[model samples]
Target: MAFSKLELFHSLILVLSVVSVQALTWTTTPFNPPAIPLAVRSPYLSAWLAQGAGAALNDVWPTFWTGSVVGWAGFVKVDGKAYSFLGAPNVPGAAFTKATQKSSQFTSTQSIFVLSAGPIDLTITFISPVEPTDLVKQSTPFAYMAVSAASTDGSPHSVQVYSDISAEWVSGDNSLTANWSTTTGNVLTHQVQLATQAVFTENNDHIQYGSAFYSTTNTVGATYQTGADVTVRAQFINNGRLPNTQDTNFRAVSNNWPVFGLAHDLGSVTSSTAPVVFSVGHLRDPAIKYIVAGGATQARSSYFWSQFSSPAALITSFLGDYANALSRARAFDSKVNIDASKISADYASVVALSIRQAMGATEITISKNSDGSFNKNDIIMFMKEISSDGNVNTVDVIFPAWPVLLYTNPALGKYLLEGLFRYQATGQYPNKWSVHDLGSSYPNALGHNDGRDEAMPVEESGNMIIMALSYAQKTGDNSHLTQYSALLDQWTQFLIEDSLIPANQISTDYFAGSLANQTNLAIKGIIGIKAMSQIAQRLGDTSKSANYSSIAASYVSQWQTLAASSSGKHVTLSYGNSASWGLTYNLYADKLLKLNLFPASVYEMQTAWYKTVAQPFGIPLDTRHTYTKSDWEIWTAGIVTDTATRDLFISSVKKWASDGLSTQPFGDWYETTNGQPEGFRARPVVGGHLALLVL
Candidate 1:
């Protein structure tokens, strides 16, 4: 007796699901990684595996999320045969063994892979212990790579493994004049600093130009520069310090991961089955030496480092309970994992890989008052600085990232809102149509960046009010609401006056350029006003609530009249214009918020139309083009109860991640037809993928 094909496939799926929940590991697409997110601690100390698979680790360079090369150290040895794992190919040495990636697995906080290198089987794992709830460790700039090697035939073998870091960690361009020195105190420390102390002076999409320090514990023989290129190489042998053996670089090319730089010693074992651990840590200091109203300076960087435990201490703490950390990641990832898994592995993969990288993009910053006090204000006011524009605490950025933060660590969400409120309380952000676009461009928080730039108009105003409602709904922490009531009132009035018919202006998709009569932006304003009314009711302002509620209801009525399609297929991009169309993604928020703003058919009709316009990568952002926003597409799909239509959108995302525009970090924007990313990668806004769970 045999089961049907469908039944057998279902069983396989079930088994895979169980394994997935137990271990968050999956294979990569061999040579192409679509960019593996490695160390995602903050905007500064972040790295990605951009190298193609099967290529020598040195052949490819590891980069920060900003696309800046940090350097490579692909040196691994098994039974004296050199193998490459982290850097390019082995430096033309004898008994070279090609290490092939067998499979890749990841938890929210780690990436693990099994490599096949001839007779020697190696399991390599990189762990970055980042727990959003733990502020100290969450922002700690450290990661660990653990390696386990054994022989297939149960033979005694002596093996060595090592890591070499690049000097690019210290400057934007490796050729820049750098001061290199080694400090040996409690541990072996190597430091790199540019000639000028230029910190937080620029706010572009490039990596920071500042100081960097790399260190290792219980390791011997480290190099700051072996050739023309700058590199930090350390060798540790047999779980102890390496013997007096240095990498003899016969081929010292400008760009090479030389086996000669420094060899890491992996302790010898009598049997084939032996395990050893080694770690590398990085510290990135950002900002000017003095305080700036825009926030984040050299003083703050040093202060945070002061509170942080040493790298050896932090790594020991991280690796000691490493299994538990992965377990926690499995559980946290399970929130989106289970839901997306119900769709397919493709869906689950996208969601699982995104959870940590998305959340880590927004660097967590804590400040203390002059009295050496740490309050809610001090607890947060982070830069929110992980985008191309390098914007800080912008309303739109907050809007997409809200759901996850609200659900996972609502306290952080509350803290974020307080930052916004503090800025608004200064009477700096104008609420006529919208507040400022950003507090200041990345790393700064002196004043609103919108003062120098064009206003987002309805975009910012609507986002602020709606995010406030979301914060309250998710966390039930309304104390901040009370604190921000006055500013809320001002913003609510702005919504009432212009929300019904927003002036031609920009949205969070400001990069796409401004648009007038934006139907979706109008939907944003409507939901915002309704949300404010709900908050007003919660605060016991019945009269004000009723007034605003009536105003929002009227706006909805008029919008539907002007924007609805006679065919009941989809809403137009603007009022009374059937030819132009856009994603009414914001309309789905009404369903989630239970505003009862639209009929059920409205959703069915819009979704039906969206499917028709869907490109291979995803449903287009609108009829404007085939380019789509990854988060908005997910949010729109999340409105549904089942995984039917929702799975299609998730599948599109899976295709994008697998073969998107480039093997770079995840961004909010991408070409829907070809998966070519336009802008905004590795942004925290992908946190919005939790929309369905929060709903």
Candidate 2:
């Protein structure tokens, strides 16, 4: 396969960009990311700056992951001259000049952009804290944007910073009537929401029930306003401050375009000036509707509700903790970078870019009491299988995302798996194999009581057992396994029957279409049986352990012969097809769990074979397509023993991260040949990028 002229041009640009930025000290290398995450905290609170052409911050409006505009705009008034620093189609009559973006870099939890506005240099940092262990801080739906300005000419400049959120942030539909008001206390909050709330529903991935909060500390020189976008922005643009007035006439989002604005009047700005910080978030009570054991629905509140009395309290604490949060986030970035760089610099870039998107898809929730308080003890971290399907707690999805969860905090891996186990333990899913996902749609964990969920019998069963053991292995806690022993046993029994040669069924790569005797699927089932043996051993069931071990070993021997190609070079995609070949990423679980189900030669063979089939961006998912799943590619990379082969996989993905054509969030699925996004984006499966880190 020859590289297209466009691909060659992107490659040249990638090389030049790296060369040009080498002299500048940055937390991470500057790359043209598919999209720059702005305030991506939860599914509903997610927003990003789509990177296209020059990838300039001021060129386009920030959009929700679904590509709808979520009107977040920022401007800096330097000596009464307004300049748009964040979003585009500059507010009319503001006479806004687009700020020149100097550089852009993203750490694990923050995206930093440096821009020039006249004599002042503005550093805008978007911080979405990733507190994996601290449920309280992590559960807070808020994300922060801090703008610090200093005179590049070494002279003091009077500067006033302004920012706003339009009513478009409230609901996806622009025609919906938006009701908004201002709350003034220690903090000034402009709250906007749909006039008629549609609870437990969504429009274009925007939750229709929540209130969007745009807030800042109520400082002496601060003012607020709620009115038409042009009216409020022009007010600040001309007077260097807002009117501090609220628009009482609630109207449609498209009607004059209502906006919530805040302005900070920094009299004299120099390097010594304090940074202006803003907090933006969405508040959704009864976050998830979950079904308990008795088929009764229960509303779950965000875990932050347990710590903070109300939305105000949570927002206040989050706003005040910016310094500490930024410190922690920087430390996390350093640790991840240093650790991942030990593998390769290319590998570090891949891991660094994926951390936020991987963790952002989740929400930590707890059951609420009758009096509206949350039950902190009964917590579950629910994941929205974003982009592809909005299913809550998808097993295969969790399997791919488990590496980061396990590496960050093993308890999180347990928390993710707990929801799946709890749902199945209720005897609602009548399938002998593991259920595909908790719910058909997100925020609704109503079990498939009718047992009509999509079936991936061998695939999901293997994922559950592997993830269950991986969590227990990392945390040294087998309590979950012991607690869900019966279900595990049932799934293992199903695997035992299907382990040797899988019947015609879909694997996790269901997009590739179904095939009988899939080589990768068979191996997963075989490894799952081995994992169940370990579980039985941990439980002191010596007879059960021996039985499973013998079955798994016998099945592996048969799988090796049947799945291997006639040339004995690499495994085929399915049994008995010499021309068929695929990623065989399932092999990573065997190595990860220390199962040693396959010999050393098998790893060496696959590693060598991958190099031959590698494309410019990545190895293809299979012979059927030119595309590949980034998560699976990383997993395959982690299983290889040789450094060259591992680096080959890592660098290819890093190249794609920098050059991929899709102007959305980081996509997990893309064309291996041209780095164009095929389908999926912003999915937690990018957590699989941490496979090398996990190793």
Candidate 3:
């Protein structure tokens, strides 16, 4: 974690100066929300910055907010006033790419700018103090650029500001340079001021030693004049990385992350108005901590803004609603503190982060067919499909989404189920089995891009049947069962007739590799029968219920015989190997979902699994892989009544979700071995974040 003296100084100066400038006088409008406390530790500071930029805007700095950790002091500006500029965050995977100037590490940023601020002058200044870190560690001189004027012509102006390293290389002063020019119009000039190390470290608190350069570039012979109400754009570009284009752009000059401006545009200006003057300042002050901390709000706001539209909006909105519900559930957990093990603070954050994280991996779509039967686009399940590269409706992906939707809003579950039902009922395929995922994440129900159907019939059928019944029970509504009775009949019949589960097909862990996984099949058959019975009961069809119940009873007995273990344990594997089953089979029986069809001892198997083989972060999904799934763990927990055991499950998931200061969107998977994020981000399965609601 330690860096060379020179490197340390460079980073310290960068973070402190970057953070301090924005913290001091950061302001938006209406009212300035409180800044994050400055005294927090560095790791937490990164988390806060991640959270601020990831969350939505209106939620925090309604008018404006921006958080960033540059090479120098971090900067957070909210409502036009700079808040805090602390030392920069440590980018662990920092590696210089020949193609890029900045390290390969991701730069997390968020901002809030006045989309329609009346004509006004805006300027920002930054300073750095040398107390928290060492002098050598805080001496990495930096350059910056603040927007002068951004008018909305055919092409709005882009303000480019960076440390004029060339100046330092030539003049040895590290003076900065600024460039601002509209696509068309008038021009304004400004000068740079570098704070001396002494002034930066001592008295010159507001503006000190690092050098600054000014630009006089102006757009000429423009179509629009100064009198027009042109949209004003406050832009910030992180040019530290080469291919400067790699650096994300914040549309406005506020503190909120980039997402906040997704729905709002920078304000326009008129010829009568003076050029928009953006103050460019830097500081190495201690107060930068608050601004750095505000990054969380900025993150949350940015995430909300980015995912708040049509294709991604539905999933994002659902995830947000679910996260809120999980928060509520966390509150409810306290009402009956006795069930502490059922949920916890860690669990709450996991679920909340899920909404904030996943749900961005897929695209939503709908298609009109020639037969007048509208076909809904299948939600693409993976970001990268071996067959489709990065396509949608992979059946495997839908499997994870069930727990998430089931926990929060059953209506969405129903919508998803109905889509599956449509495909099962009319798919071009011959079998009556539930179809695998319908399509890629982007093209919508366009068609399965994976090039194959569900090879694992029982697993998918079980998922569908169980989800239907679970939805009914959870929502206290049987209308869907009645409406889709025909499809239900078809699926139930398929389970009874051919769903003993065929050999060789994919399950949730297709990525880990596949097999004829009998334990997986047992779960499928047992759950499928249970769902059929539940559906019958809900529909008030006594005969059907009794029939399905009888069939399910028989299947349970068969399952027990086939999957039972030496110590009367429930362990099922296609190969009958205890070791492999112990690794692959979640031995945790869904006793609750099955209405206690099996003994609590079944759930105990999972508890044993957690106790014996679980890693510091999570239990492995199977023997073949060192990774685990957060969603499955929750689903397994939902079936358990032991609050303590369930809480443990929640803890494992939270550990992965919050592991590392990973601010790269919300990842749905994590490495069970090291507890680091594995794959996928911003996916809808984050609805699973509400798994705690099942309590």
lDDT of each: 0.62, 0.87, 0.39
Which has the better lDDT: candidate 1, or candidate 2? 2
Q: Would you estimate the TM-scores of all the predictions? A: 0.85, 0.96, 0.52
Give one digit per residue, the lDDT tens place, for model 3 in 1-695: 87743344335434533443344233322111122111111111111223321221111221101122211122222223222112222222232111101100111011223221122222221111111111111121211122222233433222222111111111122233211111211222122222223221211111223222212223331111110001111121121111211112212212121110100112333222222222121212211100012121100011112222331222223322333433443453333232323456445445533432232232122322456332433211122121122333444555555555554345555655554565454444455666666543222243432336546566667777777777778778876678778777877787787545446666656665567636656666666776788778778788988988888778767766666666554464553555564332222224336466665655667565554556666666666677777677776666554665566566666555434334444455677767566655434454555555654
Residue range 13-122, candidate 1, lDDT tens digits: 44533443333223542113356766666566677876322222334677877777677565566665666666543332233445776676665566776776556667
**Alpha-carbon shift of residue 379 in model 2 (angstroms):** 1.1
TM-score of decoy 3:
0.52
Q: How far does residue 23 in candidate 2 sit from its true spot (Å)?
A: 17
Q: Is candidate 1 or candidate 3 better by lDDT?
A: 1
Model 2 — TM-score against the truth? 0.96
Q: Using TM-score as the measure, name the better of candidate 2 and candidate 3.
A: 2
Error (Å) of candidate 2 at residue 87 is: 0.5
Ranking by TM-score: 2, 1, 3
The deviation in Å at residue 123 for candidate 2 is 0.6
